[model samples]
Target: MMKRLKSRLSSIVIAICLPVIVVADPIVGVWKTEPDRKSLISHIKITACGDKFCGRILSAYDASGKEVQTPNIGKKLFWDVVGEGGGKYGGGEFWVPLINVDAVPQMTLQGDKLLVKGCEHAICAHQTWSRL
Candidate 1:
């Protein structure tokens, strides 16, 4: 009887902890950014950088869908992004190299699309990016 009870307890423990071990944050993947002013798009890879969520530009392309060969490739576009769970992420800043613009961003995820809103004091901008 004791051996059977121990087996049942172990089974219950595994059942409770298995999901926590196997589950991953939904936003941890590559995402395609919306087109910029010059109609160029960027591929941003979202990953856990240090203790926070960060996205880096893996590549860039122009309106023709051709690779633009810019220095922005492999650049960290946003950092210090904290995922507060429940499809919400914030506490990050957007860094644009070309226009030299930076703003704090708040993000929400819906299905495979990420909606991000950036605000710098009174000015604000929004973009929706798709998962790649």
Candidate 2:
């Protein structure tokens, strides 16, 4: 019947468009990073870049919560990050501003927190960032 054919076509259309409708990844947000060795905190803004994701430092603050001017602001902290499902992401490069080096990065999203880790050879470090 025509009604049955039309219903099947509608189902197919929805199935094809579902992925596009849900294109926004949960990782897209502003996250507050843990204080570094200098006791400075950074707020990173994560956004969609092509099919992957990228994060940049939006601002920085001192230990007393006063916003400070830092050259690292507006710098790309991470890029080419791809979500691997189950709240895990990897395949990205992380920039360590303090050390002026790059490392392989991995991330995991848990509720309002994000665990970001970077490894260079045998050395590894991680920081927990809270969503703001």
Candidate 3:
């Protein structure tokens, strides 16, 4: 009877601890920025940079849909992501080297909308990103 009780207790402990062991999905995939008719171009790609999450230009095209080469390829797009509890990330700036603007970019994934908080140099463009 004591052995059977011990087995049941072990099973209960494992069941209780299983949820804590499950980790959230890592945000290391292609993401597309929300399109804008006013802006000439828009694109986004969230990639893993060391231990941080960084974004890059995945696609930039003119109105004709032709691929355009972006100037900010190797720049640091974002950082300080691990502190935001996995899905929420911030503490970095997003910039376009061709354009003269760098915004304090904070992003959170909710459903299919990646809400981005943009604020830098008096220019803010709140963009919603979609996973690609």
Candidate 4:
């Protein structure tokens, strides 16, 4: 019957479009990084870059929560990050501005908090950032 054929076609269309409709990753947003040693915090914006993800510094604030000028603004902090589902992401390069080094980074997202860990050679560090 034509009705049965149409119903089958509708089901196929919905199945094909469902994944595209829900493809927005939860990690795509602005996140507030933990204060550095100097007590300066930065806001990083994460967005899709190609098939991966990247984050860049959007703004910086002093310990008093006052916006400050920084030379690192608009710099890419992380790139080539791939989401591995289940709130896990890895396969990215993280830049350490303090030491001017690049490291492998792994990130985990839990609710409004993101834990970023990076290691270069024998040195390793981790920081927790919050969603802003």
| Predicted structure with the largest lDDT when compared to the true one | 2
RMSD of 1: 5.6
lDDT tens per residue, model 1, 1-132: 999999999999987775443236788789888898879899999887655788899999998899988888888889888877789999978886666798897899999999988888898888899999
TM-score per candidate: 0.79, 0.84, 0.61, 0.82
Clashing pairs in 1: none
Give the range of the ten consecutive residues with the poorest summed lDDT in model 4: 15-24
Against the reference, the lDDT scores of all candidates come to 0.84, 0.92, 0.63, 0.90
Off by over 4 Å in 1: 1-23
> What is the C-alpha RMSD, rounded to one decimal, of candidate 2?
4.3
lDDT, candidate 4, residue 41? Answer: 95
Instruction: Give the per-residue lDDT digits (tens) of candidate 4, residues 40-63.
Output: 999999987766889999999999
Each candidate: RMSD: 5.6, 4.3, 7.3, 4.8
Top candidate, metric TM-score: 2
The deviation in Å at residue 98 for candidate 3 is 6.3
Predictions ranked by TM-score, top down? 2, 4, 1, 3
Ranking by lDDT: 2, 4, 1, 3
